[model samples]
Target chain A: MQVEGLSINLATIREQCGFAEAVDVCLKHGITAIAPWRDQVAAIGLDEAARIVHSNGLKLTGLCRGGFFPAADALGREKALDDNRRAIDEAAALGADCLVLVVGGLPDGSKDIDRARRMVEEGIAAVLPHARAAQVPLAIEPLHPMYAADRACVNTLGQALDICEALGAGVGVAIDVYHVWWDPDLAKQIARAGRMKAILAHHICDWLVPTKDMLTDRGMMGDGVIDLKGIRGMIEAAGFLGAQEVEIFSADNWWKRPAEEVIATCVERFRSCC
Target chain B: MQVEGLSINLATIREQCGFAEAVDVCLKHGITAIAPWRDQVAAIGLDEAARIVHSNGLKLTGLCRGGFFPAADALGREKALDDNRRAIDEAAALGADCLVLVVGGLPDGSKDIDRARRMVEEGIAAVLPHARAAQVPLAIEPLHPMYAADRACVNTLGQALDICEALGAGVGVAIDVYHVWWDPDLAKQIARAGRMKAILAHHICDWLVPTKDMLTDRGMMGDGVIDLKGIRGMIEAAGFLGAQEVEIFSADNWWKRPAEEVIATCVERFRSCC
Candidate 1:
């Protein structure tokens, strides 16, 4: 009864359940692979979280995020690198496939995106050695351009791949359909990601037409305008046969639903829609 | 004294005034150029609007849009083309430099952005003869990626330039800072636009950090994080010495202010910020 190629990023159910309960629900629905946020792992204690994973023989698709390297001062940037090192350590402990990084945006009161982007590259490069030592591949999740100012300056897969190519190994990109489905060069960049062997993860979610909230209005797989299946085909064609991780941030609808209903819906849609 | 190189897109004060009044306000503020929406032109009738433009010797930087090419059916597609032809006529009558095209998003129930983009290209090609004859350049304004689903599928300067290149001449692009500022490849594309001589219009506006509304809520110049002078420098260096058309659609803030105040603020910002 296990779903063959699906993973649930725990943020999809962050509002409805903690790390343990979210896993229980995913398991009940035959979804054995999961990606948990660092906070989620921390909440349950990393040791306990690891214990649960080992006991269930669960596959950790990825550890939910570590980036946000850009800051106003040198000290602040160093602090961010220190934090990333810790995140890599946690991902190493969890046996996660990769550590997803939502690389930070502009420092407070700054408009220099180029500088911020340079900072992101530098921060990633600084942590590359530690991440390599820990065997946690750093996955740079290029956020949507709307989030370019406040969230992640890395806004395109091509841009992320450029960083990966620049920094050398121990760095790849997390291809989230929500952030990149609008890209005209999506297929080309995706193929490039495959060529560079820089695609570390594949995240799935639909983009709502009248996306109500910029941050939390992500749609479930089948609900919105994204050609999820088309994107998945492109990813598969690009030589990534990894689990299609579901990462919806629907505050108004899916997040309001019960954890069981959410997982059930994810499973149903993963079959019928995604 | 007239604000030498600034043009007011009437949509900036759209909520505050109609065609005649908006023109009067701009004239009073010593702003000699304006870009009015098609509806605003129609409100006072094109003849009267043209009279005002001629009498005051005002320049039309560009007309406020004509695209929305993708439709659900062939009939709908034809209807869009017919409408675009009419928009060309309006731009010609108004003596606008270009007819800015928002270029439609996905048709009803269609998730294929590639097809929608094709439809946009086809739609433009279908209307090109009329536009060329009318001598009104078609300026494809690559909207913000956030509007890629509902507003414009052409979401990058490079993508717009590609369309322009493929479609041949009589078509260029409206390089709106709000949309293209987030592009990682912005400076390079702007230079490419310059090299191609495909830079038809230069629209100016800021991107508010916590952009409240997707359609409206555009920050005034100097209000948000967009590096205005930097982008302007790029465009200017690219050999585009055209007016910086101030196009803000702030629903809650600027839209609620007096037309005179908004025009004055635009002039002030044009000098100080842009």
Candidate 2:
């Protein structure tokens, strides 16, 4: 009864469950793969979290996030790098497949996105060696262009791949359907990621037609316009057979539902739609 | 004294004025250039609108807009093409420089963006003859990727240019700062557009950091993160010296203000920021 290719990014059920409870809920549903946020792991203590993950033989598809590289000053940039190093350590301890990086956007009151982009590249190159030493691959999660100003400047699969190619080893990309499904160059870039051997993780979620909130209003898989099956085919063709991690930041809808119901829906959608 | 290089997209003050009234406000502020929507022209009758434009000696930067090509069925697509033809005629009547095309997104219940894009191309091809005959240029306004599902599938300058190259002349691009500011490949593509002589209309608007709503909530010129002067410089360097048409769709902020104040602010911001 195991859910073969389905993994739950803990954020999908973070509203209803903590690290331990969320794992318990996933275990109840026969989903043995997960990607947990750093705060969720910290709340239960990394040791206990690691124990739970190891005891259940859970697959840590990825650690939720790590990068926010661009900063207004050098001290702030150094602080981000230090924080990223800690995140890498935590990912290594959790036996994660990769550490997902939502690279930061423009510095406060700054209008130059080009400069911010350069800082992201430099920050990644700086910490990449540590990530390599820790045996944890860094997955650059290219956020949608909507988030290009405040959240993450890297907004395309091809852009992320460029950074990956520049950094050489210990770096790749996390292909999330919600952020990239709208890209015209999606198929071409996905193929390019495959050829570069840089696709680390695949995340699944739907983009609602009337996306009410810019940050939170993500739809559950099969509820929105994304061609999940088609994208999966492209990813598979690109030679990435990893779990399709379900990550929904639905503040109004999914977050309001019971964790059990949410997991069940994800399971149902994985079978029927995705 | 006419505002030398500034133009007002009537939608900026849409909630405040009708077609004739909007033109009056623009003329009163010494803003002789304006872009009016099809509905606005229809409100006062096209003949009357044309009479006003000719009498006042106003420059019509573009007629807003014409493309919503992708549809659920063939009949729907034909209807869209027919509508676009009417829009072109409207632009011709207004003596507008170009008919801006906001190429439509996925059809209802459809998930294939590639197919939607093809429909957009075919839809443009269907209308090209009419547009050419009417002597109205087609400016494909590549909307932000956020609108790719429900508004426009053409979400990048490069993508729009590719379609223009395939279709040949009478079709170019409307470079909107709000849409393309986040693009990493923006500079390169703008240069390419220059090389192809494809830059038609240059639209100016800022992208708010915490963009509250996807459709509305657009920032006025100096109010947000977009480097207006920098982008304008790029456009100018790329051989486009068209008026920077001010287009804001803020349901809450600018729309609630008096049309005079909005026009004054646009004039001020165009001077200082852009």
lDDT of 1 by residue, A1-274 (tens): 8998999999999999999999999999999999999999999999999999989999998998899999999999999999999999999999999999999999999989999999999999999999999999999999999999999999999999999999999999999999999999999999999998888899998998789899999999889999999999989998999999999999899999999999999999999998
Candidate 2, A63-88: lDDT as tens digits: 98999999999999999999999999
Residue A113, model 1, lDDT: 94
- TM for candidate 2 is 0.99
Q: Estimate each model's TM-score.
A: 0.99, 0.99
Best DockQ goes to which candidate? 2
Q: Candidate 2's residue-wise lDDT over B1-274, tens digit each? A: 7899999999999999999999999998999999999999999999999999999999999999999999999899999988999999999999999999999999999998999999999999999999999999999999999999989999999999999999998999999999999999999999999999999999998998788999899999888999999999999999999899999999999999999999999999999999
Which stretches of model 1 miss by more than 4 angstroms? none
Give fnat for candidates 1, 2 and onward, in order.
0.72, 0.94
RMSD of each: 0.9, 0.7
Categorize the docking of model 2: high
